[model samples]
Target: MSFILTLANLLSIAAAASGWLKLSDGPWSAREGLMAVEDASGIVMVGGRANLGLAAQHDVWRTPNGSSWERLPDAPFAGRAYHAMLSHGACIFVMGGQTVALLGDPFFNDVWRSCDGGETWDSLGHAPWQPRAGLAVATHNGRMVVAGGCFGSSIGAGRKFLNDVWATRDGASWELLTANASWSARSGPRLVDFNGRLLLLAGEVGFTADTQLGDIWESGDGATWTLLTATPAFSARSGHGVVNAGGSLLLIAGWHDAKCLHDQWLSEDGVVWRMVSNATWACTADACGRFDFWPVATSSGLLLTLGGSNAYSTFGKLWAETWALPLLGGGRPLRGGSVAMH
Candidate 1:
C-alpha cells in the first residue's frame, strides 16, 4: 500500500481506540482463505487470499510466539480463502474453503493433510461432496466431522447447502455419517468439539437472507446426531469465531443481523448459554473469512484475535494485529491461531 494508506490506518486505529492501539503482531499481510492451528510448539497460519484478481496463496507461516512469523512451505493446492482447517494430533487437516473471491465463490471441497507442521502439505483425497466452502470441520475420537456450507456461488441461483453430515479417519479415506437431517443447509456455521460431542451453531439457509436462529446440534459418534441446544442465546449469524474452552463453549465475533457482532456468549453444557464479553473487546470485528478474522485461544488463557487489515478500510491494511479478549479465570487455553488469510 502507499505510505498515505499506512498513515490513514494509524489514524483509523487512533479513531477506533480511544488513543492508543493495543495491537499484537504476527506474520502480517493482507490475505484470506487462510486458517490457523495452534499447539504447544507454536502457531501455524496456513494459506489464504492474496488479491481480488489473483488466486489464493497456499504459503504457510509459523510463529513460535504470537509476535513474529517465519515463512514456511506453501500448500500444494491452489491458494484459497474461507477454507475450513483444524489441527489434530500431529497433522493439520484442511478441508473445504472458497476460492479467490471468498466464501462460496470458488468453493473447494478437496481434502489435504499437513503433518510436518504446515511446512508441507499433501493431498489426502477428494471429498464426497463437490468443491465447496464455508463448511465446518471438527475432530473427535480421531475422526474429522464436517457439516453445513453451500455448494454453489450464489445462495439460490444454482448452489445448494449441506444438511448432510460426514466424517473421515484419514484424509484419503471417507465415510457417510448422515444423508440428510434437520440442520440448515447453510454456509459459515460454527462447529466445535466440546467434551466428547460435536456442537454446531448458527448459519443461513436457502435463497433467503435468513439471520440468526437459536439452535445447537450435537453429534457423538458422527453417524447419529441430536439437537442438543433447543434454545439458543444469540440469533443465528455466519462467519463467527467459535471455540471450546475449559469444558465450556465460547462464541464470539461474527456477522450477525447482517452486521458484524461485538457480543460474546458462552455455553457450559454446549446448550445452556450466557453472555460474557462484558469487560473486554469493545469493537465489532469483521467476519472470519478475511484476514484477522479468526481468533486463537492461548495456553495462557487469553483469547487472541488474529490479524487482517486496518479496521477502517481494506486498502493497504496490516495483517499483524492480535487483539486480546479477556476471559474469566479457571479455563485453560484451547487452541492457538496458526493459519493465515488475506
Candidate 2:
C-alpha cells in the first residue's frame, strides 16, 4: 500500500508540473469568431468574420473538446458581428448585432433560438429594444437579461451609447427592467452571473476618444443596480470576457487604449481584483488578441477563449484560433482522488 501510494503521488506531481497553461490553436478558424456557452452537450461557436474583407458570417459550429470542431448548418439570419449569444433552458438564443456594409452598418434587434443544438434555428422576431450591437446579454435570476450597448449606424456617426436594462423569460417577449440604470451608458460591458447575482464589468462609454470604462455594477433583480466600484483594479477596457471559475470570477483579455490586451484578472467578490497572468498570450491583429473574444467555461472546467478580432476598429483581422486555460486551482486532484488532465 505504501508503494502504491508513493507511485500515485509521484504521478500527480508529474501531471501538475507538466500542466502549465498554454495556448494552442483550435481546429476552426474565423476572421471574427464568438463562442456560445457550454450547453448540456458542448460549447458552440457562432457568427464571425469569414474573410479579410468586411464580411459578417452567420455560420455556427460546435465542439466537445476545443481541438475538434464540427460546423453546423448555416443559420437562417444574415451574417453579423459583435452579437450576443446565450444558452437558456432547452434552447440557445442569439440577439442584437450589426452587419458590415459599405454604406453604413445595419444593426439588428432580431432574436433567434435553436432547440436542436446548432443544427437548426428559428427566428424569435425583433426584440422590443431598438437595433443595436455590442450589448451585454446573459441569464440572470431565472430570466434572460440584455443591457448596455451602442445604437448607431457607424462609429461616430449618429452613435448613441445605452445603459438600458431589459429582461425576458421567453425569448420572444421582453420586459423593460429599467429604462436607465445607475451605470453610465457603455458598450461591450461584461454581463455575467456571479454569486447568484448579475454583475457588469468594464466597457467602452462613448464613440469618442478616451472613453473606456473599468467600473463594476451588481444587481439581485434586473431593475435595481448598485455600483460596486467606480474604479476597478484593471484599466478601462472593452470587449473583455468574464466567466465564473469555481467560486471566483475571472476576467480575460479585452480592448484598451487602441490596443488589444492579453492580461487576465481574478476576483472573489467582484469589487476586489488581482491580476493573475500577464501576457500569457498577446492577441494581435495577426495572432488575435482578446478583443471581442467570447470566453466560455467548458464542461471540463477550462477557460476557452473563442474567436475575436485582433483589430480594435477595423474588420478582416478576425481569429479562427482558440485558446484555453484551466480554471483557478483546477489542475490539482481533489483531496486523495486522482484527476485526469484536460
Candidate with the greatest TM-score versus the true structure: 2
Q: Model 2 off-target regions past 4 Å? A: 1-27, 103-105, 155-157, 207-209, 282-288, 329-342
lDDT of each: 0.63, 0.74
Q: Give the per-residue Cα lDDT of candidate 2 at 117.
A: 82
lDDT of 1 by residue, 92-123 (tens): 87878766555434777788887888877788
Candidate 2 RMSD to the correct structure: 5.7
Candidate 2 local accuracy as lDDT? 0.74
The clash numbers for all candidates, in the given order, read 30, 5
TM-score of 1: 0.78
Stretches > 4 Å off in candidate 1: 1-26, 50-55, 101-105, 206-209, 278-280, 284-292, 308-320, 326-342
lDDT (Cα, 0-100) at 216 in candidate 1 = 83
Q: Over all chains combined, what TM-score does candidate 2 have?
A: 0.86
Q: Give per-residue lDDT, candidate 2, residue 30.
A: 60
For candidate 2, lDDT tens digit of each residue in 174-274?
Answer: 89999999999888898988889999999887643488898999999878999999988988888788887677787877778777777667788999877
